[model samples]
Target: MAVHHQASIVPTKAELLAAWVPRQPWAAGADTSSLTKLGSYRFDDPDGEVGMETHVLATADGQVLQVPLTYRGAPRAGAEESLVTTMTHTTLGDRWIYDALHDPVYAAVLASTIATGGHEADLFLSTPDGLVLQPASARVRGSGTAPSAPAAGWSGPRVTVAGTTSRIECDGALLTVLHVLETTTASAAADELVLTGTWLGQDRPVLLAVLR
Candidate 1:
């Protein structure tokens, strides 16, 4: 489960995204004057130290994009390149944000989720009263069976971003995360492990990631 504090966050999520997203290579030449958040989903870090959340946004030009981010209490070593920015959370204090693609914790949880057929984390609000369940803005499921071993020869996650997708390779395993989402009727390949998501208006599952 992911616990959200009921405190103000400086440079709120939308403000941070507005300044960062448009500068990404995939979002080059895109108009974001009216960029609006569509939905978001979260995955729990096994250790519960880092916060993992993926936000989906729609640009004024009708382009839909997904950006995954990780929040840490302190800066991550050797991850300066992936660092988005730093912000102060009224309750939690300072936080260092980085693109999830370069965060090993995210890659590990993502791989485990796909390998064990896991779903998105449950949401809860941390209030003075106690923990309160919150409705998820989006949901996701991995297409994999239980009782499976890790991918063959898996060493660690190596990420590469090109165009509108991020490719993660772990030895022989390959997982592609779609940054730009599109509606399609195509089916997944037999050997591929897929991740699909659904939101309020989008009851139909849409492709989010694929592990091969």
Candidate 2:
């Protein structure tokens, strides 16, 4: 289970995005005037070292952007390029946040989750007295395209973007991380894995990621 902290965060998640999202080349047209967080999902690390969370932000213009982040106690070595920001947490202390794609641990869990058809981990809030269950945002699920060994680079190590979609080329499969989700139906091809997100009252399946 992923325990959520009810303690204060130095810089709120929205504040960090306001400073970092504008710098992204793909978010050029994004309306940074306001960033409303839609919801977030979590993945657990088998080693229990890194904290993985993927946040989806909605712009004023109805654009949905996905930003996966990995929190580390210390600075991630050799990931200076992918570092977003660092902040002090009342419960966890200092944390280094980096783009999930640049973190090997995030990639491994993400790939494995997709290949094995996994769901988001259960989350509970850590309180002063004890742990309390919190309402999760939405449901997130994944399915693997090509069934194979879920290794570290099963979905490639480096990241590249094609238009609004991000692409990661692995040894035998290609993974696509959809940055901007569209409501239109997506044509399915043979041997493809897709991750979807859903919210209350909204039954539309938003394609979050794909692997083929």
Model 1 local distance difference test score: 0.85
lDDT by residue (tens digit), candidate 1, 47-161: 8899999998889998778889999999988889999999999999999999998887887777777778888999999988999999999989888896764655433468887
What Cα-based lDDT does every candidate model obtain?
0.85, 0.77
Error of 1 at 58 (Å): 1.1
lDDT of 2 by residue, 1-212 (tens): 78888778979887898888777776777776778888888888888888998888888888878888899999977889999999899989999989886677776776667777887888888878998887778667776544653654542376786777777666655667777777555445656777887755447877888766
Q: Provide the TM-score for each candidate, comma-separated.
A: 0.93, 0.90
Error of 2 at 15 (Å): 0.4
Task: Give me the candidate number with maximum TM-score.
Answer: 1
Candidate 1 — which residues are off by over 4 angstroms?
148-156, 184-186
Prediction-by-prediction clash tally: 0, 0
